[model samples]
Target: MAIDDSLATGQRSLGDPAHDYPLWPPLTSGCPRTSTEDVSYPVEVDYAYDKADPAALFSPVRARGGLERWAPLLPPLPAPGLGEGATPLVEIEPGVYVKDESRNPTWSHKDRLNRCTTSAAVGVGAPGIAVASSGNHGASAAAYAARAGLPCVVFTGPDTPPAVDAFLNAYGAVVLPVPWEARWPLLRLVVERLGLHPVSNLTTTHTGHAYGPEGYKTVAYEIFQDVGVPSAVFVPTGYGELLFGVWKGFEELRRLGLADRVPRVFACESAASGALHRAFAEGAPAAHVTVGASEAYSIASPVSGYRGVLAVRASGGRALLVDDRQLADAQGELARAGLWTELSAAAGLAGLRSLGGQAPEDGPVVCVSTSSGFKDKGMGTHRTAPATPTWEEVERRLRAAGIAG
Candidate 1:
């Protein structure tokens, strides 16, 4: 149980049960990766990798109340749920399963990021929190900020999801509906002046702030516990944080000997943008392009991240671009599975289906469903019922609809 001798150096080791995870490459690269001025730029997060095994992450001596194993350098925040681990590893087929992240507190996996990002807000002593999102991340940040009693502000797009919008409002976040292009500058101004924390990725590149992915690593933790290691994981890629986080989690699990091997990290993106799709093939870190429109708006991004490339390469995975029609079909299949998720959420399922459903069974097939179907603001599915409600009238209606109760 000794620390990897090579990994040992000037680390403040807690032989009792704790350790810090570093974020930078070795200093011997002859590049002082971290400098205080980088606090202005912050190239390498002031963090380090730990010798702690993945299985020991929840041990009391190593954990904060046995929930989160504090990021060796990342800030602390509210731990959502009762450790938020043990989320349902639901079976979709004999071996395939969907990690229904929608069941999380805000009905999406963003809770994991929120838990970590909000912790950053607390750690940095931000007066408040802010984000440019009209979806799960916005609502999640608001709720987490409220839980932490930090003031929260959210810059939403005009087309922001109604369910998520209402959640932000309910949490009393200062919700500002701004145009998409205006978000980053506005966030910059706000952060410079008001000192509010920005949770979403400000970098046109998609590195999403440091702490958000820290929380998202929990998804991998849960998956490993459920099935040990899967043949592959299909993630609904948006900013690519969740994709990279899940990949990193699984990778860390393997490093810790908790899981046997790595799963194929599938980056499922909407065909509208295909940033990850193109970047992966080009063998580059990340790339930027113009975003085309699609029903999977959550993932319609022209830019991807460096971490995304690392995830795919490290796991021997592929980047998948799914069309809108295929996405619709995937949503239907999931509905049949009794999992009602949004079109973007179904993107992962679509990628799996495109794989011919012949995925191997190293453990379980996980499709990272990102959000609820209620997130589809353009959904006109809900309509007023027809007139009349008597037993005979309902019977006649059911007959016309080919339903019998």
Candidate 2:
């Protein structure tokens, strides 16, 4: 059950019986692969840990960086630090806090993921890293790869946000905007032919990079450190790496005797897909849902991974779905509270709101806002007035708008 690789015990597949694999090279081709199949599935990393002495981890030296504070439990890989972790937990209401992940180096939660996945590339001796994303993921991967001095390639859909395009270019990543269906095949080729480390999903059912979610575990650790375990955590879910990682982190804490119990983790997804929601409703092993239009494209994953389902079921959590209307309302609420989150990032808040009177009656609630507003696909779609008016006219306009009434 345990294969030693530093403090990391090993990895295992999500299937029944949980097939184990050695820790090195990440078992990236998938765990327990048979000659009869060629598809790769998700696997989880197992850590060997003693009861946690929180003081040992909370020292001044370790307070700054992200997951590096828990290096013993993670893969032994060199970090290309871009200040990806250690984001703020700001309380916007009486009993709810927003874990603002946009404060990361790349202005999104994907920075946490890339830091781990890119380190995996370094650990595995890969020349570069490749992923299929035009949003936060690609930009973050490019940034981390640049920091690591590795070539980066991003396969995105053609209608990528200009800000994201600029971000990828700034980090010197080669971007290929092709058909949506073509991205995975191209990414697989990048992994197979060029030996680049693939960080995103390239499988049938969305088994994401094993190390990527390790970065997300730090979110839970940081939350526990700041506010203790909340009653529940609402996370914007795509492939569910962040959801699973946060749950796993809490699991580690409980295993290490740091917390009394793990919090209920909520998977907040766009109603357009709601893959995890469908899976849970159907009691299926994995998510399979029809894709539809959604403004929160970042988390509207057509295929949901078992990791998310496992996180929800294991943590006694629920999967909540929100439409674009609810997403916009949540975004407005966050903006009013001085957190300008992307539509996708607001899914967590929307999910929390959807709870209505059914919300748990004990403990604080934490909603993870994943990225900045600028990452929204309609970033600059608003109109502005020309500045040809005099001060008097401006004041008149302000009065007319009721700003200076």
Stretches of candidate 2 off by over 4 Å are: 1-6, 33-41, 51-53, 58-62, 357-360
What is residue 160's positional error in candidate 1, in angstroms? 1.7
Best by lDDT: 2
Writing each residue's lDDT as its tens digit, candidate 2 over 1-405 gives: 011223777777766435777877686645555311333457878766763355676443437765566777676558557766889999988888999999999899988888778888888889899989959999999999999999999999889988789888999999999988899888898889998999888778777787788878889988988888999999999888899999999988888777889999999999999988988898875767788988788987878877888899999999998999999999999999999999999999999999881346789999999999989998877888786569988998889888996
Q: What is the TM-score of each candidate against the true structure?
A: 0.82, 0.93
* TM match of model 2 to true structure: 0.93
- After superposition, the stretches of candidate 1 with alpha carbons farther than 4 Å from their true spots are 1-75, 78-85, 361-363, 379-381, 390-405
What does the lDDT come to for candidate 1? Answer: 0.70
Per-residue C-alpha lDDT of model 1 across residues 85-172, encoded as one tens digit per residue: 3457778888888988887777778887787667667656678887888687888888888888888878889888676677789999
Q: Which ten residues in a row have the lowest lDDT in candidate 1?
A: 35-44
Query: What is the TM-score (0 to 1) of candidate 1?
Result: 0.82
| lDDT (CA) per prediction | 0.70, 0.83
